[model samples]
Target: MRHTDVVIIGGGPAGLAAAVKLWEQGIRDILILEREHHLGGILRQCIHDGFGLTRFGETLSGPEYAQRFIDQVEKYKIPYITDVTVIGLDKEKKVTAAHKEGILEIQAKAVVLAMGCRERTRGAISIPGERPAGVYTAGVAQAYMNLQNIMVGKEVIILGSGDIGMIMARRMTLEGAHVKGVFEVQPYASGLPRNVEQCLNDYGIPLKLSHTVTDIKGRDRLESVVISQVDEKMQPVPGTEKEYPCDTLILSVGLIPENELSLMAGVKLDERTKGPEVNEKHETTVPGIFAAGNVLQVHDLVDFVSMEAEELADSVAEYIKKDEKAEAEHTQGEEAEEYMADVVTDGNVSHTVPQKISGKKDIRLCMRVRRPMKNCAIQLIQGGKVIQEKKMKKAIPAEMIQIPVKAGILKEKENLEVKVIW
Candidate 1:
């Protein structure tokens, strides 16, 4: 088996950033494996601007943002292989992948899972309709337009107010295609505030909140989609059905973290994030295995993904140094599984990542609310007592709440709860 100091799966923003950070930490012998022929991941398909606003302070396109790190990866001469599909990962940190050269197995001291996320397709959402060619995921249409130079269709009816859908509504309008309207089951826009304002409002694309595409009347290609208003239960109001004629129906329902490899490697998963359960260091329950980026939790922006990778790189360094010290001492035996207290949530809180708190260190809880709340307060409670409380102007499920709690605070009590005071 070929060996490496660290093996990073999926050479996207997460992998690239981690490699760069790890190299900066004086750690080399890193290998990044990517399934695609090129790096950059989904960023290559996103041609529109508005990226890098957080990190670079300059509004950049997705490709431009990704190139910033890709250039760094090349400048540092970090080794990475394209068109290599990682098939399996063992608990022992053995990675099995298939390449043109043949099956390759890598024994790694540390493995960073950066496979990112996948767009939820028609089947996943269970849209009632005939399987039609004109139907496409927002990401697919994005790729078709930006990378392949192909226009998907003339008229589009997008389902779901996901950021991609909102962006595509404006993108299609710019490309001379008519975006009839964007339908969302939720009352509020699911994407960012800026995306809703710029991509939809500015383009005069109608955002039909509290509405959904109940039925699609397409056979060979898309003919029309039946739209209807939904009640409080998010169920379609029967008599409110109206047909919108369109050749293309774009689905941008949601994103699911690509965590099969993590599960295969025996990493415990957070049900809410649908990703790996990580510690503050971003290390998983499996000692040498770590996760970052959308694979760990679906991040709203690429900048956050990069930040996670930077921190994760440091954690990997810490793991390596500790492992080396243990080996030298001949005390490198397997570590007994330690108890990790659950970070429970109540009220409008949907879920919290790094669900299990282990060791004593300052922790950042990345959480998402179940719904939007105005003039809300967040509380960190320990054993029915409020340890910390902070007020917020607003909190939305679409945005991740980065709550920092000081170290040694978790060990102070038996149960930790995050309650949203609305």
Candidate 2:
């Protein structure tokens, strides 16, 4: 079959960034396979301005932000095939894909998993309701409105105050639709503070926390929804149902990392993040197979996704530079276990990226807290001693917390622990 030094799946932001970085490192034999007909991934549908602030120090729309990378790929003449959906991946780095022509196979020296993520739907959360036509995920609604020039509904009820949901609430309002309200099951808003303020407060859209839609009304099309307050356990409170009439119900519950191909390649998954477990180098348990972007962990920002992909690209370059036989032998049996350190977290931590570290160099640990807390400190512990600690004014589940640790303190440590205390 065809052979390449690197084969990246999904020509999204992550794959684009990784491919560019690999090319910059003098890796010429590279190919990118994208399932969609075009590049840019989710950013193509996201038309709002406010992206690229951290990455480019400027406010840009989603398409504009993605275009910068797309331009770079063109300048470098990086090869990418669109409308090609990868159907299978093996441990030996062979990729099977299907396109308009027929089945395609590639023998890759290294594979980067950049498949990104998918929006959680009504059925995923098990929202009790009759199947209605007006219900849509926030992303789907965005694509319909921005790409297809179709309005989802006149009156909208958004469930889950996710960043996308909040943004859609503002979009619907601007489009002359009356947004009933945004209901969240969590005690606190799931979206960023800026989103809640700019999207909801500025538009006068009420965000009802500790509340959820218990029942959905209407038969063929959405007519109304029953909202109810939730207790500490997030269970719906009795006799607290409030009916709000609306033509559409938009769900922004959550995002799940796309990993069906990764699983086929036998990558170990982290239950906490619902993504593949990776080391500091972003390499999965299956050697030469690496994952980045949302496929590794759900990132709060697209900038971070690109940054992580670049870092993983560096590791992939190093892998290609080494002897394949020696690298494989070194990562087997007891040597592999000794080469990596296990990372453990306290109950306060929701999850972490790079579940293991080499302890050979400094690393930036990324994680999120379980809930919001004021006056908290995140401690990096080794052998029951706090090696490093960072105090924060506040910690929230909506934001990711990154801490940089020194290698000197972690060198001899077999296990490292992370604790969030308030």
**Model 1 residue 50 CA deviation in Å:** 2.0
RMSD of each: 1.5, 2.3
Residue-level lDDT of model 1, residues 387-415, one tens digit each, is: 88889999987888897888766663255
How much lDDT does each candidate structure score?
A: 0.88, 0.91
Give the TM-scores of the predictions, in the order they appear.
0.96, 0.96
Candidate 2 lDDT score at position 97: 96
Per lDDT, the best of the predicted structures is 2
| Model 2 / residue 47 / CA error / Å | 1.0
